[model samples]
Target: MANIKEHLLNTLEELATEDLKMFQWHLTNNVEDDKHIPKSRLEKADRHDTVDNMVQKYGQIGAVEITLDILKKMNNNQLAEELRTKVKNN
Candidate 1:
């Protein structure tokens, strides 16, 4: 059987550069989704506020785990591994 950790790491390595944008986009969307405000009202939200909201909703580790899961589900293994390493080393 393939090692899931290695597979995830390989996927991260392969797509890390390109998939970063995709991951960030998804992260932003996911964070926004948790907001109670209407989508139409979110236009005034600042980047820092949005990120703060995400951390508020998920905490640091939880937010990272959620984003990693999102990347994995989207078949963005390379980017996921890159994030995993960042989190691990930080």
Candidate 2:
């Protein structure tokens, strides 16, 4: 298996437009804290904003690292696998 960072970064880019929007909303508003989407982050990411909000919302260093890792190695098969794994885990 690949290193955790490589695996995650290579996988993160698989998130669809809606998935990315939800992720941004969850991060900026702290879904655990807000329990609902934050419109600001949603709009920002939809408007093609930065990944900075993800770092701030997730706060767990591992999440950001993994996202970067996944985004780095995006591919159809990898994205499909990553999505399957993520959904199962969630």
Candidate 3:
């Protein structure tokens, strides 16, 4: 199984630029205040940086669940399900 970082990167790679922006926005805004990734930080992050930051802030499982939540908020249920399946299989 791929590591969590690789899984996150693979999932993020599926998004278009606009969708990625929306995903980041949701990520930044949807969490409890203490758990939020700063908009300033997310603004400059590429996929790798984004994944690293998420893992740093939330740990692997929390980061994956947060990503799933953001994806669902963006109406990307298919991607969320795909990511959940991948994580479960691993």
Candidate 4:
């Protein structure tokens, strides 16, 4: 089974640049308080950097949950389901 970080990276790697930006936008605006990621941090972050920051702030499972939630909110249900399935299978 892949580690949570690898799963996250793989999931993010699937995104196009614009979609990735939208994903980051949701991460910045949708979450509150401790779950919030600073715009400055996300401003220049790539997929790996974003995953690193998420893991740092929320740990592994928390990051995955947040990713799943944001993906769903973005109406990217296909990716969200893929992530859920991967996590479940692992």
Name the candidate, 2 or 4, with the larger lDDT value: 4
Q: Rank the candidates by lDDT, best first.
A: 4, 3, 1, 2
TM-score for each predicted model, relative to the true structure: 0.49, 0.37, 0.95, 0.94
Model 2 agreement with the true structure over 8-76: per-residue lDDT tens digits: 444444567766654454454543554333566457453223334443445435454435443433334
Per-residue alpha-carbon lDDT of model 4 for 1-90, expressed as tens digits?
Answer: 798899999999999999999999988888986689999999999999999989998899999999999998888899999998898888
How close to the true structure is residue 16 of candidate 4, measured as C-alpha lDDT?
94
TM-score of decoy 1: 0.49
lDDT of each: 0.54, 0.46, 0.90, 0.92
Give me the candidate number with maximum TM-score: 3
Question: For candidate 3, lDDT tens digit of each residue in 1-90?
Answer: 798778889999999989988888877988999999999999989888889989999999999999999998889999899889898889
- What local lDDT does model 3 show for residue 34? 95
Candidate 2, superposed: residue stretches over 4 Å from native:
1-10, 28-30, 34-37, 46-50, 60-90
lDDT of 3 at 27: 73
Point out where model 4 deviates above 4 Å.
Answer: none
Top candidate on lDDT is 4
**Total backbone collisions for each predicted model:** 4, 9, 0, 0
lDDT of 1 by residue, 1-90 (tens): 433333334443454444544544555565446533334333444434434444566666665677678778788676778777766765
Alpha-carbon RMSD, each predicted model: 8.9, 8.3, 0.8, 0.9
